[model samples]
Target: MTLSALDQLKNLTTVVADSSDLEAIRQFRPLDATTNPSLITAAAAQPENKALIEAAFEQARAENYENGELIERAIDILTVKFGVEILKLIEGRVSTEVDASLSYDTAATVAKAKELLHLYQSYGIAKERVLIKIASTWEGIQAARLLEIEGIHCNLTLLFGLHQAQACADAKVTLISPFVGRILDWYKKAENVSSYPIDKDPGVQSVKQIYNYYKQQGIHTQVMGASFRSIDQVLGLAGCDLLTIAPALLEQLEQDQREVTAALSVTAAQQASVIERPVQDEQSFKAEVEHDLMAAQLLQSGIDGFIKAREQLHALLRQSFGLDEEIKA
Candidate 1:
């Protein structure tokens, strides 16, 4: 009997469930979990989660919040509520994102991350058990750096380029989640090509590029490939520090018993040519992003998408409390 592809991955990588679906995480039994407003919105629509939704709203009202404040507090509590459930089922930390609208506000991002930490603590969960996820914008990276100094770990997400990855390494943050599928999606749409050769797949190459660069530089900011669209993409980066995968793909791996091989080698990365660039700061980071069309577009779009999703979640919460009409008026 050959080992399943996922089994092979688990041997070399720390598998994380990239979803807010508790059942998916429980069934897959991944070591860690990650959630974002987009994922949470998807989960919020499910009938099974109605009780949790109501509970979050009730908690906010009990705190004497009114109108907009009630909605905002419920959003925070709802995120933490999901985190609490996820933490109960997994021993590893859960990555809960700060509001994406704050992506470019250093102080605001930092404050939001702190509020999330405080909320987790209020739930009796230690700060160490949570990774406050922030975007990898220039401001986001700097915010993570500040949080790191205060002993808070961060996962810099929505990453689309090596420049940001390099900056993240310089920041000495806990991890970087480079988006694999999104990059490929961009290239495919731009190039009008249906497919590329397996090994030449752009998304797979992106993660490998970041991973190799990290290893060659001896940077400890772990490279975790995220937003994968296919199993081949997952197998292509089998030896990443971590891979946060959707449960649908996890199910595909679970049902298949094919052999999986180690696709990345840190030793190889160390032996690979080093990519040299100046250390990044706010100004240089902005300039570099402007120069790279893909990174700039993706960063803005990612933030916009998350912000929209967060708003949707809030609207859902308001509707749940029968305040949607009142708020509209």
Candidate 2:
């Protein structure tokens, strides 16, 4: 029998399970995995993941032997636990995000990223087995650029514009995740419309433009489409470097036996879009992104959401340690 859409995608794209639920990852067998603070908070609340959470605290107790220290330690412990689990199944890297509270602080973002990598290394995880997830702000990109030179790969998240991709490419980061569903969400809300063309969906268009630009410039930074609102959005960009899809949508793809074909190609990119000019510098890039309302709001909102989720996770850890969770609140 011919391959299903999911199988065909497996051939073209590095399927990434975008969830903190390790069980869901086992079900899909994605080649990679990604998790944000929000997903980690959600997963930690579940009954199944409670053991993992408790184990984190236990491991922390073994090290620092204090409630506050346990809480701090659990953050690294739980995160690496997820990465370790996923690494067992996937051949590629697993992305664990930095503390969202540090997104605006380039130095802090770089510090926390190194801490995460150190924890992974302590657990026998190779440096190549991880991609430090960072927000695509100017600070985040700068942090990633520094780490990339140290042999630490990065996955730049919350990317919503061509400028973000260009910056990341210039930084020579390992990968960039363009959020497809989130972009669609923004355009729909702005236009007061219910639907739009799959191919022309603002999110899809954003990734396509970034993808073409990268290929045209011969930038090796991978483009991974994320945050899909529907399978149609996922199907719309079938040949991206990677697509960190949710488990529910992965199931939908597995069940839908539709014919899948390449919607992007190097040949077409070379012929159609020419990078006749040099990449934008920081000043112009920042100015250009500031002019785009949707990108600005989405980028800020995405960062805010991560910060809130990180606060929630910290609250959970505090409560788990019999500390004052309200302080975290």
Best by the TM-score measure: 1
Model 1 clashing residue pairs (backbone): none
- Cα lDDT tens digits, model 1, 28-112, are 8998999999999999899999998889889888999889888888889989999999999998999999999999899999999
C-alpha lDDT of residue 308 in model 1? 94
Model 1 segments beyond 4 Å from truth? Answer: 326-329
Residues 1-329 of candidate 2: C-alpha lDDT, one tens digit per residue:
97778998888777899998888988888888999989989988888777888888888887865655557668778988878878988787899999877887899988989989988998899999899999999989999999999999999999998888889998999999999988898899999999998867989988988888888889899999999999888888888888999999999999888888877777777777575545577788788779989889999999999889877888888876678754532
What's the residue-level lDDT of 119 in candidate 2?
Answer: 86
Clashes of each: 0, 0
Best by lDDT: 1
Clashing pairs in 2: none
lDDT of 1: 0.90
Q: Report, for every candidate in turn, its global Cα lDDT versus the true structure.
A: 0.90, 0.87
